[model samples]
Target chain A: MAMLTDLLVISAANRIIGLIRDVFVALDPDTAQAVEVLLYFLVMVLYAILCELLLNGQTLGKRIFKLRVVDASGLRLEPSQVIIRNLLRLVDGLPMFYLLGGITCLLNTRMQRLGDIAASTVVVRIPEVSHPDLDNVLGSKYNSLLEHRHLCARLRQRVTPEVAAIALEALTRRDRLDPVARLKVFAGLAAHFRELVDFPAAATESLGDEQYVRNVVEILYRAG
Target chain B: MLIDLPRFVNAERPHWQALEAILKRFENDPDLRLPIDEAQRFHYLYQRTGSALSRISTFASEPELKQYLEWLVSRAYSIIHGQAERRRFHPWRWFTVTLPTTFRRRIQAFQMSLALTVLGALFGVIALAIDPEAKSALMPFSHLTGRPSERVAQENADRGKRLEGRKTTFSASLMTHNTKVAIFTMGLGISYGLGTIVLLFYNGVILGAVAFDYVMDGQTIFLLGWLLPHGVIEIPAILLGGQAGFIIAHALIGWGDRRITRAQRIREAAPDIVTIIAGAGVFLIWAGIVEAFFSQYHEPVVPYGIKIAFGCVEFAGLIFFLWKGGANSEQNNSSKA
Candidate 1:
């Protein structure tokens, strides 16, 4: 998708170059042709270099794909790295399209093409995280699990933070889940939490699996 | 370790934010340097943020918060730990000093490049002498494959009128094409120098075949006049490209030193490789202009002696520049030390 978008952009730039060439061609044919060829190659080569340099290692394609080129050694991207890598498109784009690059990427552990290997850079997905509204997810509704103080304390102690976090995430994103998926997920969570501690029948019997998880999260998060 | 998560975040958030802002400034301007006090402060913030991350990493219930802290620590870590020098660029210093210094440092590779080309040229001369028909295959261009005397007659008769209107376009094409070839030749180093060797030898073969063809046809003056002006610079530029390729190959093969890994060796040589290739590119551009505007014109229009003299002068200048251009600076630095 990024390659397509970049190609489209290059095509549009070529059209503009053509228009500019027409004006020059009327005055000096040789100069016009020279300008056209120079401009064409410049646009093709500089597209990635300029974008990666100015945009913090993100080209238009990389931006669209939510990917960024970063130094494999976790250093700032140097100008030399950007230039050397882009110049290497000559080899990476061998035979036809990026067949050589693609195969190299697949075979390599870090999935770096020849350019990336030479430049010491890697393309990484920019992870996006949505902060959950803790207040809304764990509202003031009375938590039945909290009624049995001893069992609630044990549940909190036994449930690893990872499990507790997963439960919170499910509750926070519950509205976006499919009905069947929601039921299955909540059922699984409730079963896992139940095995951690034995809450009396009265505390959990009236609560549904989803509500039971809501009660468990409140106990884990809110101290009595 | 089981501290209050809310209080912990409240206490550390400001430091994390401070580190992020500093990192942003560093990333935006690579050449930016901080005062000693500010540098100390930056280090403090990084350490504090890293500590917070360790604390939060264990209590991983707040996935989003942990992710944010991890991101901050990572960005800070890179800024602090990167080993590549980030000095501000000075084009004059690079062209006169750094470029020559790097070339001289890798002189052996350049010699290897020269040897390979010479070897290939010898092969071409021998093969063509054995079978004259091989000229068609050896020098494939239509203009080149024909009899040299006929071509010289044609060039002298036309006196560059054939290229009168298209010189600029021709120059641009040459610059772009040669620059592309130079870069590709350097890049092929990743193929363990095998590809670079093949390309350099192939170029030499073409050069040898053409030289032999002209000499045999008794058009040596015309041939030298035509090739010398541009070939002096252009051939060396390509050799520089080959030199870079061999540098990369040497680093890959570890150069018989296992104290460092292949990656470290490549990383160490990368800056020099770029420097040599860029120098080659600059040379090729000049060669291109010369080839189009000056080399193409022949005897009656522009004398062969003048062209040959110009080429010799250019070659001498190039050798002197490579050998001693940066020597003064080296002496000053050593004396100061």
Candidate 2:
């Protein structure tokens, strides 16, 4: 995601630069050619240095591809390495297509292209996950097991950590289990704690066994 | 700290269960509220939920469960951010990304300018060839032609003596005339494309007539000496100036009434105008240099050959450097996105 954003930004910037160059040329065709050549050289140098050094070896294009360039030791790449990697772009672009480099990425486990290998960089997806409000968990717009606030409060107080852990494990493994098997696992866990808590015999059926187990754990934890 | 247990239970069993346990334990814990920035919050959510969510396909057999899970996620997001609505999409942001790509794609206009100039020059030559009398007809003065041969020789001798004596004034007048001509060519090039064509046509006709006049007078050699030195740069510079005019005119027309908002058009046209003005400056400067130096030097064969060589080099260089399509490999890569 970060790589995609960075690539989009860089692409936008490149277009602005190209437009400026065009205006210069339009103003004076005779001198615009020289200005264009100079501008191209400058842009190339800037791309190599900024992308390789400051950006940790990820050009806008590379970033969009969810890749980064790092040294052999998995550290930020050096300026010389960045230059070499970029210069090698011409080579990677050889043989009439990007076939050579594209094939390398396809075969590699980490998806490192020639440029990545040369610059010693790898691209990894960065994930995000952290919710701050625990109170809203039971009251969540998504929860349906406990409809009333009082019922949710009562269940939160009765739930226990052990039951919560078991419920989480069961839920995580739920995909591999048949519906009957999944219910059995939740019922079994709920049964272990049923003696310590007051609840209806059919509570596990109305409230999904997973939800039942989770409610038991939440109630126990709140009480403790 | 109020918990809506019903909605949580209605969500996908796995996510709901996992979330329920966490929320129940931390429900009343004030210390769980970490005062982190929004970016950090998003990052944390992405890391935790992305991994967990990736483990299971959210395609539940129960439609209510699927809807509940979607609602739960969205509600959680809203609670964290304090906003249920997404930010509005600003078109300018997209324009910024796309505008540059569009401007750089104007190699077509440059090619058109080159083609028009060449065609105009070609037609001018053809027109001059079809009308032999047109050359003398266009000349402003005809009284000097009525004099006898000897009298004309005497008059030329006297005028040459006078010109030698007042060299500074004569040179100043010539400079003034050249400056006026160059300026006129540059300024008139802005008449949509017509002005540029007219400039090219007139310049071409003048060139053909001068050459033809010298040939008729049996002084073709002298004509070559008189014109070639400066005509090389002068002619091309005039054509370029005219081309710049055509570019500006085309840009104005191309930006015509479109659904694109007014503000967007302004932003788009600003850069184009800047480029055209800059190019015009270059053309003017080159014209000044050629007029002051080359045009002043009325040498024989050497100067003529040098001028012709410069013209050939300029033509070839423009074609080579501005050779569209293949030069934009970097752009091609960016465009793939």
Candidate 3:
């Protein structure tokens, strides 16, 4: 993605240079060439700066990859910070090919390059988020656990958020699991929940391990 | 400790939405400054939302709600605690007030940069004086390998004609190359000052060796004419680069207060480092133009005395600028008082 960003920036710079040169056809050949080189350098330096600023801390490449440059302190990135970090590319590119920058990034705890350290910026990946479809997973099944309101309340209280999440995930992904693994997972979850809250023998005797787990999930997620 | 996840989310969703709306405004337009009442309301929403997130954090059901609240609280925390404000930039004030003031503030780093260069220059002079055979090794450039007298004669004979058609190209190359060197010098400060020191010293060595060789060959007038016009600005620009580098090194080393973290120190020094380097870059551009267009013309085409005088004037102007450029600004006055 970084390399792709570099290629896009270079291509854009070359196109701009060509357009400018065409407009100034009467210029001396050496002077024209000088302008091209100077413009190329300027564009190369400013490309990231402009893109990051205008696009909310993302270059074209970073945007494509859902990566962003943010303030390491968890604040909004300041313009001066942007300029300082980008300018430090001169040092990062030192000895050639960003070797120095790459080494510094590897050594640093936050994976920040020298430029990032100086500027107090960090590049982070933005994860894609969507609400889990609870209705689809926990259908309107006849939950025998809901019959004992007292035990259902107790079960919700005793179950930790982490444990609840694991149960929910297991139920949601049950189809993807093999039959033996699926049975084993439900057995484990039912045992854990059963220990947390004891339902009566009448509520337990008729329910299979899978159906028992499903009833618990529905009770935990849905209201009567 | 018990949480009714649906009821809790239902009660707090409006506050979370309000806070998100405010944050979206800040994010979309970083320079936006809210009115006092609006700002207070924003603060209220953040605190309220934060309180709600803490309550639901331990709840077992509704992981999606927990994640959403965590995201909101994190954004609010960043916005509320951020030290830097997005202000409009004024270039004239930056050059006159900010640049010189920053230079004055970080003068110690500049002094260290100067000291290292001088020490390196002294080393170069002694080494060359003792072993003239090391001239080729000391001066890496092919043009500088020959005797100074011969090079001066060749330059005089050309009378600036050598750069007639390609002056702009030469100038552009000089500007870009010198600017890169300056930036590289400053960037090396990340090495905790070691790399910066070595680079500055190496630069001084080359300068000293070349000057000594020219003076010894009885071509002092020609050398001065050739170098002074651009050297006056170019040398100081390089020094500014060194100065910025030393500043970074000092911050990393925590030379002063032990209480401040490395990140805080670097953050505080960032604006000044940027100011000095930008100033150096501007100076280099001017020096590049002068070196290609004016310094190359020697003897009959452009007299040595005029070139030397021009360099002196430039030196004086630069010193005056750095010493007292923004001394009378309103902000400076208020600070002084």
TM-score leader = 3
Ranking of all candidate structures by their DockQ, best first: 3, 1, 2
Q: Evaluate candidate 3 and give its CAPRI docking class based on DockQ.
A: medium
lDDT per residue for candidate 1 within A2-90, as digits (tens), equals 77888888899999999999998999999999999989988988898899888888889888988888887776666777877788888
Instruction: Name the top DockQ candidate.
Output: 3
Error of 2 at A79 (Å): 36
Candidate 1 vs candidate 3, TM-score winner: 3
Worst 10 residues of 3 chain A by lDDT: A125-134
Q: Which runs of model 3 end up more than 4 angstroms from their true locations?
A: A22-26, A146-166, A199-204, A215-224, B330-332, B335-337
Off by over 4 Å in 2: A1-224, B1-127, B136-192, B211-229, B255-267, B300-303, B310-337
Worst 10-residue lDDT window for candidate 2 chain A reads: A125-134
Q: Predictions ranked by lDDT, top down?
A: 1, 3, 2
**After best superposition, candidate 1 residue A150: deviation in angstroms?**
11
What are the runs in model 1 whose C-alpha is more than 4 Å off?
Answer: A133-140, A144-184, A196-206, A216-224
Q: Can you write out model 3's per-residue Cα lDDT over A1-224, one digit (the tens) per residue? A: 76577677779779989888777647678878789879988887788888888887888888888888888877767776787788888888868988989999999998999889878889887655566677888777777778887777677767787888888899899999999999999999999989988999998899888888888877676643
Q: Taking the tens digit of each residue's C-alpha lDDT, what string does model 2 give over B1-337?
A: 3334344334435555554444333223312443457446544543445443333223111223333344335324423532123233344532343323433454454455556656654554555568755545544456323322333345334433433333333333343344334434433433345655666666655565555555656655445543554455445445544544454455335455566643233233433433333333344445445544444443331344565565566556544433432335546776986
Name the lDDT value of residue B97 in candidate 1: 94
Candidate 1: clashing pairs of residues: none
Could you tell me the TM-score of candidate 3? 0.93
lDDT of 1 by residue, B1-337 (tens): 4555566677788888898899889867777788989999999998998888787665435556767777777777877876636777788999999999889989999998999899889888888999999999998798888888998999999988988899999999998899888988899988889999999999888888889889999999998899999999999999999999898788878777779877667667888998999899899989999999999999799999999999999999999999998988878977999
* CA lDDT scores, all candidates in order: 0.86, 0.46, 0.85
